[model samples]
Target: MGIHLHKLALVGAIALGAFGLAACGSGSSDSEGGATGVENPTPVGGSWEKGNFLPVSTFTDRCVSPRSGTDPITGSAYADVLGTRQDENNWLRSMSNELYLWYDEIEDKDPARFDSSLTYFEELRTFALTPSGREKDRFHFTEPTNEWLSQSESGIYIGYGVQWALISSEPPRKALVAYLDQEDSSLPDAITRGAEVISVDGVDLANGSDVDTLNEGMWPAKSGESHEFKILPLGASDPVTVTLVSAEVESDPVQHVKVETTDSDRKVGYMLFNDHIAKAEGELIDAITELESEGIDDLILDLRYNGGGYLDIAAELAYMIAGDNSVGQSFEHMQFNDQHPEINPVTGAPLDPTPFHTSALGLADDSLKGYPLPTLNLPRLFVLTSGNTCSASEAIINGLRGVDVEVIQIGETTCGKPYGFYPLDNCGTTYFTIQFSGANAKGFGEYSDGFVPNGPFGTEADLPGCEVDDDFDHLLGDVNEARFAAALNYIEGGDCGDVAVKAFAEFGTSNRLLESNVSVPKEISRSNRIMVR
Candidate 1:
């Protein structure tokens, strides 16, 4: 779940480690009262005071060092790693330490010198490998402990292994701040900002109050570019120094507005869903409702950025789309660890004897039916896809496709991570991927690269004449009825040509291939499994 990272105690993680301390064993005095008879004093736990975090109005909005990727297949594109500055690595290492993980020994065969980000990533790897059952309480995962161990051993980045903690010990006035510094010469300036508070009185950001109280003015962007967010102490002198950890830019919004001058008769709804988080789903529905009111019909559901989240949200949205069809169909099914029970990974105590299982939309009793929505024999539905669309997102796309939904896909591929995660907290670290099995509709559970989009993954639909309504964009007291009319006409059946496609493509669906050059794996099944829950 991409959004789940922010929802996880991420802000808390930033704040709990907000205070910087000198190295622990560096000859610090821990004298009770008078100096110890011994010469150098032993270091004690790191100390933090009530530090104030201020808003950063001035930022070094420069570019960042370039990132290098290798061609795992041919090794032809191997290049030395960039962005290896000591400060950058230092930041990542600091974050890793905050995660309570350590750096595993680096390989002599490392592609390049150990930079900060890589160093931090290495620390995470180490923690994943040599987890001292004692420190496992820091991280959180949705997968069961056994599954996590298995996947971790395989060394994949399927489920995000995020950890959460508290930021302040005081009566809740502490804030966690993040800064976006894009001052490297290698890459373009791509950092942006947004804000969300986790608690007014020990509440979580997902509960709604925290986000409502967040001061949105703290971070500004370059014109239309998007930025991430973080909260800080009331008055921290250096706001830029406190970096807010976030996912990539492509994974933020669930919906976008694209308008152009084309007159294509097709009115498509391009909706990007990057996670199954309920809050984000709610936002997505609200956006769709708004669009519907504005007169939009045909839609493109973009799951390219989704990583997965609460399964219930996925089911609900599917039901809304399916309408009455969900009544008899099984959209998706989940599996649980009903097998060998080990000592509870968390407490080392006996675990619950029974495991839990549910459909993607959960279950239905005789009293209440589940997902009672009928399928809208809607128009062709194009699902813009990519390698990042994972888990529940994959489930929805794969399931819907089984039911003869005109699920046109335009994307490279989907991330082959379909198992559900059951959260397990042990000691202080939270263990994810603990227990989960494959979740598919009826016949679609083969793992490999989940769901390869059929046909060419082309750019989004191009429709013209859908510019921002003049009434909304103009300051004139008179309404721009013509602008509204144009929007309406385009939604009904007007073609905008390439300009329309280009506008929609800006939302990141242009790169998907109609067909992949790479060969599909045999392990990845093509059978359709449509489930209705």
Candidate 2:
């Protein structure tokens, strides 16, 4: 399974002084009786508000509690105290207000879903806040606070260090290894990309009855668990059995960076930018610096598998690519809920647009701070994308186009996410709720269905590019690979041959065939939601 590190904006600095008085007061005693003589009380954190307080309950007790109650202060019966608690902390407080986008309809739909017994994260799932009507707002979720914090600091995850693609979903349910992390030494040499799965843990993948077992083996719930797989390498006739142990693996976001001359003798700088984490900022700078020295004529940004990360990094990359053209332009304009439309929720100030940043941000050390960014200064950009290209990656495309740079999008449609948030930690879970939507300088951010390749006739949001399917037959960086070849062909005023078009057509038609027969591993297929720091 692939490891994903979500892009999260750091929480805005809290005014400790505001909570100083609240912390000094004793917490309200239980209504039933005086406090028991328990010596070690749980350490308290954050501000104490009477409405936010509730009797803590164990897991079993919490599930059986009443769904609604009267607030002592307001003397009003409420169905959603969990919702109220979230409203107090969520950047977009309007979600809890009477005028929320779906307020009337959702209240009539299923009010029970908002009960306190249900978690705040679960209640957010019931809201419809996205303009796209596709429920793009539903990507909000939570992860273990420790896990979220650790992965944000260091891109490490517990997994088998392999990415899988469901190539065929007929009765046999075939899956192919997409890529293996080169940084993980624990992965065996036999488990290479393009290897075909025969069976998992003695359960025949060809047998429909064992589908559940196959999925469990492929995506184990915990690390150190072992799974044996029968696999066939690219040209092997006989399947070999290998046991893989899931372990902690570090992901390198920039997998490949190089310069290659095309058939037309144009030097094309290629970069496989997988994510927008802090580490990626320095790596991208290094890649661009090298490409600048070599004097490349064009750039191909491969974001085929990038999920997303920090917004600041996306702004930096746009500035690096567009150079002086992006200096005075808005990279993205964040739009909050209607209630706080004119204010920045995180900072409590008037909405300030984020411009193309010329320097690195949020790095632990002062190195690279205010350092001049390198630029290719090209009038056009070639961005390679897939269904996996999303969030901050999409921001790069929108941000560049905002500055009027020609962005030629290659490959399939992007994941189509324009919303972002600052992850909030409550209890032991880190919650991610969509707090703001973003637009480019042209005021266009409505492509929630995703940006498709522009073909002969182009849509308003489309770019001049071809929709080429991923070519697993050839390695990603190879010049003959379908998507890269299409980009090169377009650049040289050539057309993709009939054979390539036919192949892509077949691939698109067989969407069900490629769809996973079982659930995809969460680490590999996690939703692309940007968390603002």
Candidate 3:
């Protein structure tokens, strides 16, 4: 049988939201009762006995019968399945067996933490090949509940509906409401952006002992969980206590899109792209078409908070930005494990590099079918970023650079992740293991430590363009906002003058330690991901 392409639609809770499957050919094995006389080998202990290990095992049943037991401490019945501690060793072995890169580097971990499945998973990833000390291969997780996966894929969440930032780590730790999800109209008007979080669950934030309580209140596991918070409004001196109940919230990925005329008579298109979901593609196309009609001189893509989503959308966006200049060029190259260098493990076919997509995929109907992508066709592009910019968002920068397009990056370094996976649902939990590493047309994919700003950080190499700290004082999209101002200044042929290079010192070591001690929450803070399908 001929190999057919299969797309994997894995959605991350935090960063890159969606991913498209690579050009992998899927075909039946001759040994599986096909015309060929070759016999198929049996799988043992999650290891493949014959043929290509990855794709073959991926499609075949490779899992061994899990051991069962009872938890001594909790007296709960447990099965040694995918999410149990008894399967820790097998899980690690399986990850090492299939991970695209760094599999050989995984160290043997102790299985004693089997009582705590999440901790065991963490220990399993401790040996990942982290060249720059910043863990890029550290997204392996088991959700407390399966609903999180569906919620993430649908761009709906259950939380307080506020994105917060730890503003200070001094004696009195301070957190500020960075932004609010307006779609969650259930939130009180007093809980607007820039509001100060004074206390959570009656635990004063100034007290060092309250960190644990604060984190729990902020990231509750279930919807309808209520937490009492004392917040100081943006301009208020008195504090008001409010009990906020978590609820399911729908998000709008394209927060803002407009055409702005700079002081120098340049018609610039600005788009605040926050998430990469199904909805974003149409929004982006509409924005681009509008800008093209307005005869815009340049475009500014604000992805400072975009965690990433949908590789196809990323390619589409790149095509819209570069237009004809990108045709006939490789958009991205997916590199699977060493065993399958030229073949797609998922499809069992010769690997074909992904090219710049000219048309939208996965649309409901002909509304966007064969719609010609609008392009800025500018030689250079300005992208505003922060540590949160990741995955498919980075793909945009890398894909553009591969085609010799100038990408002027401003703000902080990105959460360097060039790896992606097809999320696997085993038992009751979703597992994300790096299955492929991506490269641009130029074959440059060595950004594991992350893409640094203007200068290099440790082993991470510096990217093209200057770096500037985020101006938190000014609202995002404002002309005076430090990052935006820096981009605008560069557009006007000016330089960032005397901009202080300050580290984001919100979460101190103690606070970080406290956070780690807590149980891993179902919701993730950053969605560092690449989804296929």
The C-alpha lDDT values of all candidates are 0.32, 0.59, 0.60
Candidate 1, residues 371-453, lDDT tens digits: the string is: 23223335345454544455666666655544445454444355555455433221111223222334434455544334543
Scored against the true structure, residue 486 in model 2 reaches a CA lDDT of 79
- What's the lDDT for candidate 2? 0.59
Poorest 10 consecutive residues of model 2 by lDDT? 16-25
Candidate 2 structure quality by residue, lDDT tens digits, 132-167? 455545455556545665555445667677766665
TM-score of each: 0.38, 0.76, 0.77
Off by over 4 Å in 3: 1-92, 108-120, 123-131, 169-171, 183-186, 363-371, 456-461, 497-526
lDDT of 3 by residue, 324-415 (tens): 89988999999976866776655455778888988776442346767777887877788887766777888888888899888888776776
Cα-based RMSD of the predictions, in order?
Answer: 20.5, 10.1, 9.9
Q: Which candidate is the best by lDDT?
A: 3
Lowest lDDT 10-residue stretch of candidate 1 = 520-529
Index of the highest-TM-score prediction: 3
lDDT of 1: 0.32
